[model samples]
Target chain A: MKNKSIELMKRYRFFAIMIVVTLAILVVKPDMGVRVYSLAFNSVFEMLGVLPPIFILIGLLDVWVKKETMVKYMGKDSGIIGVLLGFFLGSAAAGPLYGAFPVAGVFLNKGSRLANVFIIVGAWASMKIPLLLFEVAAMGWQFTLIRLVMDIFGVLVIAYSMEKILNDDDERQIYELARKMSQ
Target chain B: MIMTIIFYGLAVIGLVFSFVKSREKTKMALMKALKAFENILPQFLGIVLLIGVILSILSPQQISQLIGENSGWVGVVIATVIGSITLIPGFLAFPLAAALLENGAGYMQIGAFVSSLMMVGIVTMPVEVLYFGKKATLLRNGMGLVFSILVAMVIGGIMS
Candidate 1:
């Protein structure tokens, strides 16, 4: 029991330190404390709201989507189709970039091409379809359209660039890490 | 709100279909989901708190003041730096950027901020590293940072 508790503490050490720091801020500056507390509370709520469905979908995808199917669609030789699918999957996703990481890990585990996975991350980070509405509303169509085009281009460039940069050993290590994490 | 509904709806449909197909696999999926969530929970909590601290210190008003219309390349640099370090949600970030624009912040600066905010995540690097190793994480963020600068220049050129 003690060992388990210690392990838990180690896992949560950063969070613990943050709590201490927040408390210290609260004591030192009550106004900043209140702002931080509310901001943190809102983010916590947002995180909870967005995370459940994503994790559940990821789990379902892991079970239902066969590795062969994933590879066929997104593997090294999947080509243009894989690229389009990666962008589609990512643009369709709803959540923050952090939420995309686990899904990316699952993609790697499922034999997805490295470039495809990077495309997904890039799309998730910037080109989400739903958020595009928000962007257009706030930034105007001209600004939004330009940024959208640039972002799509940037995603492709970054994805392929990373793919080219990483050696065979790096790719294997990434895949291995994903497999271990997903398991 | 609509997105949330769509997500939950899809998840429910998936769960129902999986359960109908095989109860054992459904159970396994739930277990995997739970385990994955647990694994990342610590990092998530830490990131949330870190964001809270960063946002509180650098409020939207301060951000606008720092990146005014004539702030030029220096402002873009500062904007990208702030965006890279902080993890602001899109909902808040968009409105904040719009407000910054209204408050005389340059297009280049806002472009840099938005692009970097989406692409580069210094605060969430721990979680990213857990999934993608240090080398890949660093390289991706480096690319993202460089790309954000490019994005800023393009927006500045055409828009301004």
Candidate 2:
């Protein structure tokens, strides 16, 4: 009985919180539940359909993507070229959020710099030239161009600042070693 | 509905297997389910709340007005920002985008919003921190937000 209670508490805590929040909304705003439930359920259904495929893809990637190749190109010793490669590869492989999760996790464990991991995920989740082109054909070229430029520039800043701000000694050591070798 | 069934079926299979199999295999299945639940639940609720706000405060007509094709670059920017904070899959978002387009919302704005909404999420901030370290999470989300805006605008501009 005690064990069961503890397990239930652990698992249901968040779900309880959700219920309380929903109830609070109901009390504050009559009929809120109707709209919220409608929206939430629909969104949930769609997300469910997408996540499994994304996870399967990531699982396959883990199995198929050669570890040695990742080391040779995206290894700790690699430089700016490594960063560029990371960016392009991430952008090219854009998929669901769940998909990127394990992929990023594997990369982190395998010596991919935290900074590059950050950038790759950002680029992958956000940038996809082919998809953007479809959106552009619908919206406008000028708007599309401006937005793309801003995004790339912003990602660069984000990657740089995250590296600097996190202030991890390990990353700094790698960055400095790479910098020294170029000179 | 189908996913729920699959989850239940898989869960039962997992349980029965665990019951018969070694502790190691059983533990692994439990861990996977726990991980999936951990990732899905909170952000899922967060999304529900945000959608509530949009529905209660902004009418479907209002959404069309604000994100209208003629709303200009500023409208696209606003949509992109909104999208970054909201988390939804492409399947739902794209369909909604199709509808919004019919309703007079610009493709670029929807595009930006969709990309950002899926890619970036303030809603999942806590989970992201737990999954990825604080700095990495912040940096990735920050970039996702910015890039999504660009994606929307570029898509919008080219199409328009």
Candidate 3:
């Protein structure tokens, strides 16, 4: 019961705050507040519409991405090759920053080191390789290429720096999870 | 029915392959949902509100005058810088850039601006910091800003 309440609160805090803020705004200026909320909500819903296809792709990957691949290629000590492996995997992985975070957490759980996970998640947030292909088609090849190159370089710089800076904070559960998975 | 059938077929293939391989079901489901929600929905809304507000506030004419004045190279620089700062959504960035292009804005400027919009974003800095740490986010974003401008210039030179 205690856990349930905490979970509910965690999930609904943004929703609750939004509602309260809207109410406060409405009290201050009724018509304008409704207008703004309506606009914001409409925008949010439109964003939500892009969810399904991405989800389907994720479903496909759940069956595909492997532990050995991650370990051999994207492992912490595996230098440039590992970095390339991380960059490729991350760029290929679909989604925005939020989507990448939970996956990174999972990677940590799966015995993937903090650094590789950082690189991968960073790429996921910043790099959109597949989307760039469409962008080039609609907008021009040069434009897309420039942006893609910039993004790749940026991700590399950030990922490398992060590999230097961040302390390993993962709990002992990494080995535990690795053991369970192998079993 | 065909689409649904295909979906089920794919799902069955995926699920069967996983289950037979002894993969974890709950982890897989949660993972799928999380990735999807993270990518598409966020960009969609994030783009719409950001572009909507900017367009609502600043007219195309205003934008053209401020950053669209020069077709040679100056406009490209200004547009790229502004776009980098503003952080427009990906899907929406193109259509809007297209409009700006049609209305006397240079393609290179549009290109650069659109490029920079995604690459260099101040609004997302907080979240980036949270995930990647403060120093890396700042340095990377700083690098991104420089790279985005250079990208705009090169694309501008190529087109113009």
Position A7, candidate 2: lDDT: 65
* Candidates' C-alpha lDDT: 0.92, 0.60, 0.57
Q: Which candidate is the best by TM-score?
A: 1
> Residues A1-183, candidate 1, lDDT per residue (tens digit)?
999999899889999999999999999999999889888998888887778999999999999999999999999899999999999999998888999899999999999999999999999999999999999999989888888999999999999999999999988899988887787
Off by over 4 Å in 3: A1-39, A46-69, A79-81, A93-98, A108-127, A165-183, B1-16, B19-24, B27-65, B71-88, B106-112, B125-130, B133-135
Ranking by DockQ: 1, 3, 2
Q: Which ten residues in a row have the lowest lDDT in candidate 3 chain A?
A: A174-183
What does candidate 3's lDDT look like per residue over B1-160, in tens digits? 2323443456566666666766676356547655434433333344444433444445456776766636556777778667755644455556677677777787667766766675566645544443345655566567666766666666667776
Report the lDDT tens digits of candidate 3 across residue range A79-166.
Answer: 7777676677677654344445435544554447656765776576556676566576677776666667767776666566655654
Compared with the true structure, model 2 gives a TM-score of 0.63
Error of 1 at B32 (Å): 0.5
**Stretches > 4 Å off in candidate 2:** A1-14, A23-31, A60-69, A92-99, A169-183, B1-60, B64-81, B88-120, B139-160
Best by lDDT: 1
**Pairs of residues clashing in candidate 1:** none
What is each candidate's DockQ, to 2 decimals? 0.80, 0.17, 0.21
Worst ten-residue run, lDDT, model 3 chain B? Answer: B36-45
Q: State how far residue A155 of model 1 sits from its true place (Å).
A: 0.6
